[model samples]
Target: MQINGKTAISYHYFQRIKESLTFAATVAALLLTQLRVALIMSLVRYFKLINIFQVLFKLFTIEFGIDSSGSALDLANENIVLNELNQGKVSFVKGDATTFMKGAISENELWDLVILDPPKLAPRKKVLQSASGMYRSLNALAMQVVKPGGLLMTCSCSGAMTQSGMFLKTIQGAASMAGRKVTVLRQAGAACDHPIDPAYPEGQYLSNYLLRVA
Candidate 1:
């Protein structure tokens, strides 16, 4: 309908308001949906049900010392073997691994056994290259600090890289850079607590290797 100037202006104003309200509502709905999905995923992860078998395997099989600033008793309860180690021979350094390794320990000081258990280097596909570089640097540092005839236990939880490929490359690269030769002793993974479904190899993420510095 043809309207007078004032009437047409009022009608256009209302149309603009309606369009703005629709856009705001659409954005709110998208935000709410994203929040809900994040909440659900967090809950699943918290309960460990999304990967229950894998969790169980990791808890059961891995034999490593727990490192915490607090008393080992506090963290050891999570693993029976670690608990025993805490009470017995395993050493717990209450410091960051990289810093601890770099600190005042004499160049002559030698660690017969060094365990490099860093967290997941990369969780996303896009960051794999950067993560690998980080991993290589970590290994290089560890190798420099490890004594001849000492054992280096290094690992990666980045599923983007294959276990065999990443582990071998990391050790070899580190050894080459450090001007040392390494002999692989053993390879390990998550324990019975974190069982991996044969069909779902992605669930099998932890990779460990024991190598002797030569």
Candidate 2:
């Protein structure tokens, strides 16, 4: 029913997913789900959150671009365990996230949910401009792939980025450009383990939103 984080100072992320995704008339319709859980840095997996999807749906898929794989420490077997865990239930594919999204649109591929967790793009303030452009285009493509009334979980882990407004605007712009209206159901931030200290502004590096594409 809830996703409790690993640490003693855990956070509950169940509401984030529960609010964003809307189930269709049949519970079986939830089979085609997609969860990009947590950060997109090397396509990390928060099993605590991922299990929520497992318990609720089936025949789902996950997207992690070929470029976004592996940590410096486990270059050879970084994804082995995650892949093994999701082997039969979810399809884990490698490709360009934006490109795959656009391709899915053209191919008329749709899903019950689309989770978008991009990497920490604007790490430095100087590159925020380029990161903004990337955010717009990426969301636009994502909008095209989501089925009507489906969900979108977009996240930003760029510490330099604004804590509010900019992200919603970028996604809203994408919806406009895609000729679809996506509603903002709710907004949230880092898990408890990744807390934001009042004293250190730069310590905040995450912003997430639960959206519904209509």
Candidate 3:
């Protein structure tokens, strides 16, 4: 599927998340009447994403899909109408992820879950250092906005960042910066369908981690 004019190569992660979301939704259903989720730099179809979460949870969900691009938000809205999903469940916010997180923190806003899927910050190894800083800063802000003991799903699509074997360390750094304690619940790469060749490590460009923040 094409998302925002690009082929959805990482769609597999969405499927993997669906499985986890089912379990999360089940837990939420037992404890709450609704689920609040925030997707930073989602850059995809909001309705499809919202539908997936709602269908799994079988409860009202409020999703804030934050992206900087107005066009992406437009496409997300278009997708909602195209898919016939409930429009009221999703809110598209146009803003930078870091800025949004800062605002949320100032307002003491929090969510049950937060998904940080920013665009590749470092396309080449040479820029990895600067990219790591950017990643850490953004993630620290994200951590502060997640409710204590809430779930956080973060991803780095930069091959350089993933291959450096520093993503987990980066998250630890972020936790420290945010004054939050985070425990890794799961760590994974691209889904099974997105095979990675041993000789071509770049094929393993995606690193995903699920954590519990306190």
Best by lDDT: 3
Could you tell me how far off, in angstroms, the CA of residue 19 lies in candidate 1 after the best superposition?
A: 82
Cα shift from native, residue 7, model 3 (Å): 22
Index of the highest-TM-score prediction = 3
Instruction: Encode model 3's per-residue lDDT on 89-201: one tens digit a residue.
Output: 77888988888889889999887677788888999999999999999998999899887766787888899999999899999999999999998866777766578999987
lDDT of 1 by residue, 1-214 (tens): 0111122223323432555423222242222111100010011112222132132222222222334334442343334353232222223334455554455244543443355656666787688778888778777767665556445666676776553356678668878877878887666676566789989878878776766666
Q: Using TM-score as the measure, what is the rank order of every candidate, best first?
A: 3, 2, 1
Candidate 2 residue runs with Cα over 4 Å from true position = 1-44, 47-50, 56-67, 70-86
Error of 3 at 9 (Å): 21
- TM-score of each model, in listed order: 0.57, 0.70, 0.80
Candidate 1 lDDT at 36 equals 9
Residue 106 miss distance in model 2 (angstroms): 1.3
TM-score of 1: 0.57
Question: In candidate 1, which residue pairs get closer than 3 Å at backbone N, Cα or C atoms, i.e. clash?
Answer: 53-195, 54-194, 56-193, 56-194, 57-191, 57-192, 57-193, 57-194, 58-194, 61-191
Lowest summed lDDT window (length 10), candidate 2 = 1-10
Spell out the clash pairs found in candidate 3.
Answer: none
| Model 3 accuracy (lDDT, Cα) | 0.72
Misplaced by over 4 Å in model 3 are: 1-31, 43-57
